[model samples]
Target: MSLLISFSHLISRTFLLDFLYLFSVQIAQQVKLNKEFFSLDPATGLDGKIYGLPLYGGTDALFYNPKLFEEAGLDPNKPPKTWAELQEYAKKLTKPEKGQYGMGIYGKTVHAVRIMHYMSNAGANGDILRLNRKKNNSWDILVNSPASLKAWQYLRKFVDDKSIPPNTVELTYPDLISLFAQGKVAMLTTGPWGIATIKAANPNIEFRVALHPTPDGKPPKLRTAPLITVISKRSKNPNEAYTFLKYLTIQIGAEMAGKGYGVLTQTAANTPQVKNNPMMKVFADQQKYAYFSAQELLLAEWLKCKDQAWGPAWEGMLMGSVSPKEAVNQAAKRIKEILGDKGNLIYPVK
Candidate 1:
């Protein structure tokens, strides 16, 4: 009986692939990964026939304070669907004199994705990274493109208009949620995880979530991150291991969804039971446009690049220390340096 190494819920599909790519044959040969669960993102696994199973998924959405909407005379039930409307809502909702802010801008490393996610919805198409068949599986960076510039500029406006919290560049995950739960901010760009966190913090707070807003009139594109599991090729009982893998990811995974846990199975997501639940239904509907970012599968180097490169650069723009275009150009240059030949800069890194 040979050992079966199961990568379930601990590491990501990206890390698993990295391990396999670097140590193929010596450590693994053909791992069983459930790529079907991510049909929303067609480019999820570029290397084909790789490792892992699937797990819970989460995506960014617009979470708003219904009470604040009523107070500001905006439609509480109808959250802003476009960036233009969001600006107007924020204008009305912002009452800095009364310690209320329109939005909670999370510019910290982990939470900064909230802003970039919204940017992607605005048609930036992942901003810094894009898939081009012409590039032979490599990616291109568009951080300095006009769409990307507009996205950051809008974010900068939120800061300049005093529509977001003071010193927003410092807020991160639970911090922004805490502010939103406390009624200090009227809206947030968060996901299902935030709903639970907000409820636990302020059980009586009245809040609602809508799909992420877009600049165009069309529906927004959604972005998601999911935990995936994989079976190492080292396993001797490949057939037996896959049977258990399906049970864990499909069978039991469906059962866990009842408790508000994420389910990667579209069947589980579209189950009549799940569609009946408002929150789960929202996420299920959003899955159509949700895509995993390149960082999830390309190179682990992107994680450090995001933190050390874009994090500070975005913060600088928000703080008025740098212009939005300048900030983005700098981020593009740094990302190119980090990605090297693997990522070509669409805009010159000047």
Candidate 2:
């Protein structure tokens, strides 16, 4: 009886292992996935395996009110193409007496990720953290690099010019979305999720989407956060779990995109339902340039560093309590401490 019990346990464990292996292989062979949405397991490093499927993903782009542009004496059809132009447009759209600001800068809780979007676009190599191809594929922290500093300095211009809301430091993305919906802010950089939120808030607001502006009018690299689905290794029926996953990711994902609930990550899943919506179209177009940030790739280390180090440092810089260089250095120090020999630090030589 004891031998039979032990054998039964062994057989169950073996079945679980086999199911997991087959599930991974089936996903690779059967599913059509966006390669950019494919993520590496930070806990295990890159094992060259597919463990999850992204149902939908979100990416940031410039959202401007066309009416505000017209009111500011700027061409409604021609949005800013570069950071300099964005600054200029913000100055024009800002109307202090009317309680209106040209731009919305997210500075409150969880603002580190949003700010990273700007840093990513301004990165010299199009990323804040890059894998060094020549250095055993080690990650390089470039948050304190010159391009990043320049991005910070550019943001400071809004504070100095009073183009951002007076309560900017007290507001997060949702707050900014509310402000934008109320027509208190002229422009914002946010994800597609903002569309439904804005429309639900105010159906009368006229807005358009554009690709995020870059430092030199080059192609922008924005941060993407993908909503992925994975099956548990302990599932009783792996095949049934996979079937459900397909249903949710493909059929339901497309329905969500069509209804303006969210954006789908699967290209083939993008039927007329996705393409028909003007706002959804822009987001779909922006996916080609969207990527996951290093902080996102390594969630454990990032959670430790973001609020404790990066958030405070970033807020300090935005509020003029610290310089851009000081903020970057401060955050980088804590990040390195947390990361600790995980990868090589590649700060530009002074």
C-alpha lDDT values of all predictions: 0.70, 0.69
* Cα lDDT for residue 84, candidate 2: 93
How many clashes show up per model? 6, 0
- Give the per-residue Cα lDDT of candidate 2 at 41: 29
- Candidate No. with top TM-score: 1
> How does each model score on TM-score?
0.86, 0.82
* lDDT comparing candidate 2 with the true structure: 0.69
Clashing pairs in 2: none
Off by over 4 Å in 1: 1-18, 21-42, 48-50, 110-112, 124-126, 131-137, 271-273
Model 1 lDDT per residue over 1-350, tens place: 12224333223344644664443232123342334464434355555433444456667778899999999999888888888888889888999899899977877644445766766755544466775656776668877777788888888878878899887878777788898999999998776667688899999998887877888646667656666555555667766766676677677767666455664576678676677777666766676666676455555566656776788788898788999889989988888887788778887766
Worst 10 residues of 1 by lDDT: 23-32
> What's the true lDDT of residue 288 in model 1?
63
Give per-residue lDDT, candidate 2, residue 203. Answer: 95
TM-score, prediction 1: 0.86
